[model samples]
Target: MEEHGTTQPGDGTTLVPGPGSAFRRTLLRRMLPAVAAAGLGITGIAGVAHGAAGGPQRTAAADFPTWGTRWVVHADADTRSPAVGMVNASAPGKDRITADYQVDTGRRVCEGSSCSSYMAHLTGPVSGFLTVVAVAIPQDRLPGIPVQGAPPPQPGVSRQEMLARAATWLTADNGAQVSYSQAKVWKDGYRQDCSGYVSMALRLPTPGTNTVGLATDRGLTRPVPLGELKGGDLLIDATGDNNRHVVIFEKWNDAAHSSYTAFEQRGGHGTDHRSLTYGLPGGDAEFTPYRPVAFSD
Candidate 1:
């Protein structure tokens, strides 16, 4: 992973505090309403509005492609004053910004299979929202690169077969490991911990692009929601009270599906997937979406 330029405090940049900070808490309070309005159900807000100016809007079916190749989110490239700043005061002048992202698919061994890994980047400043007002784009709009190198596979490999292969690679006892205690360590070793694992799983590259984690590392700020989850998405236990961990949403089983699931890694211990369920006991899991760098039609 290559290092990107850092945003200065005076440059309208604010550092994304670790989970449990007053900053994250305040941001989440403002975002809950917007998320509810999007129809994911927050609390006091209504469901997503179904119409536009002229006629009824087309809605994607529940089984529609919840996953996308690439994803893009654009902001008021003309907005003056940062809605959420690093320090006390607001940001200055019109400083429009745009971000592009490549989602990480983790290891290919778990393709189409029921497996687990963590996704990060998506929960950062560029993608995560501080105020419900920031503009965002979904994966349906931005497509990702087609799968390359290997020729197309034979007739039919069930989701089970593909997942088995992907899992082999992911759980292999290789020495690669990540830790959250030190950001500089990850920057230096290019390895990932739970959060980095999820970020890498989505194929999110090092900074220099509109990638989520990179943007977060770059000082883009926001709070994330859990109900809006999709594959290649990030789950964060931001409160830092519960075991601080980051994981990916590989599957969403409606049958007997509790609020969360369990995640198992090669060296890491097993983690409950439902830990991300919104309005949980300890604290809610924050979520953000990312685009797949190698996703295809």
Candidate 2:
């Protein structure tokens, strides 16, 4: 057992404070072993654990299982800031920042032939200490060269099924809200952006393709007239990196086809199901409606 004022978690050693500050240091030296033997854990003390001499020292975070299992981390001591570390749920322009990540225990992040750290996965956009928001793991880099490209899209995904998937992000039980982020991928392994959200709804592979891929991939979607748009169609603007965006067309808002309701993952807003006028007359001309290739219709 190593002797120290305070220890890290699971070290089998800890600091026991006394009534007087002077006595604290003096009493700890004498009582540490007894406390360790008795397995006494006193709150408010940082515990450190180490193996036998020439053995390994494991951090509490390191001890946590990586892949599959979900973990929550805080930004500060008070547990107030949930958006920290490799996963950030903070909305665009929000000052909240973090690197605390949800990781796949055994899987490491890889870039081409070069692999470095563990990959991050997140559960929600933003969260509290107890709130299990979207799962976020550390993604050392955005557009990371994933060890494997996204698996092929699931076949025969229905429009209703796609809408149900999109609804998950809107429901309170599903994190009540998902904060917008381009750099982070959601627990489901899709990018946390408009195109990513649509990919998730479309049952595309993890770490989904970008807006351009969704819009231009003839095998993914085909251009359709605005009047022909249906429940699971898309209104995408695939012009350029900075100006590109997409939304999942849910249904027409009215019989007139003047406006429509859609699901969109946009900046500032994580995931939203709302009415839109992107392709309607006098609306944003950049948007063009399209039908996913997977749909039977």
Candidate 3:
């Protein structure tokens, strides 16, 4: 049980939607709402790039034998800009590309034996021509494509190991706490938020589960009383919104239990090991304690 309560300063970060940027508008109007319904919200943007392959509908991978790639023609030819649009291999003419869509670059047009189609997102709007590439899917491999929002399989972990994992970001990258950003991921591929941090500590699948998943997913965690919170447990404010926050419980401050020590990755503070009153009487009442169901110890 670790109980020190001093904060180590970490860089603060923010995302300013670019004015008149088509990508920003498209992301806000199209991708966000879809991803939100998928239980990922805005933070899921980073994970989508890594080939979490589900879409509104599932098509048999066998139906498509070739994946399409296109070069973005824009004002800045030297600086390649990703063109964002819905890819309809079946569509004719300009009917295919419209609005903004986040493309999952991680899921290639062809994987060993399986194949999947992908969409690409432009960081900004650029007017130019497109050069399309048709890559044939290798026939030797079997079809095994992952759907979007699907988490990869992982094994259980011990409490000591979990805490140790949590401690790494405190001084990760030579004494720099992993910078916090919903739009970004740490070096390990986990989002840099409180819930993401806890997910990393618990050794969950990459990009990590969102706050709602951590609190409600029976396979990940279960409700536990504040009095019972032990090392590696969690205090999550699962509001199912952008304001949600979570912390890894280190230990209680005293027998009275007015506060406790925790590891949290917060906006403006990054990863921190400090005292928190989240579930206490006068603190934010939204926080509820939970225990990871995957704990091996």
Task: Kindly list the per-residue Cα lDDT of model 3 for residues 89-108, writing each as its tens digit.
Answer: 23222222211232233322
Regions of model 3 farther than 4 Å from truth: 1-156, 240-242
Candidate with better lDDT, 1 vs 3: 3
How well does candidate 1 match the true structure in TM-score terms? 0.29
Per residue, candidate 2 scores C-alpha lDDT tens digits across 230-289 of: 898999988853478999888898889889999888897678888899878988888988
Please list all clashing residue pairs in model 3, or write none if there are none.
53-147, 53-148, 54-147, 54-148, 103-119, 113-141
lDDT of 1 by residue, 184-273 (tens): 113211122454344333333221122234225433223344454445433444445644544544555564334554242212432123
Model 2 bad stretches (over 4 Å): 1-156, 172-174, 240-242
Using all chains and alpha carbons, the TM-scores for the candidates as numbered come to: 0.29, 0.51, 0.52
Q: What is candidate 3's CA lDDT for residue 198?
A: 82
Model 1 worst lDDT window (10 residues): 61-70
In candidate 2, position 295 carries an lDDT of: 91
Whichever of 2 and 3 has more lDDT, that candidate is 3
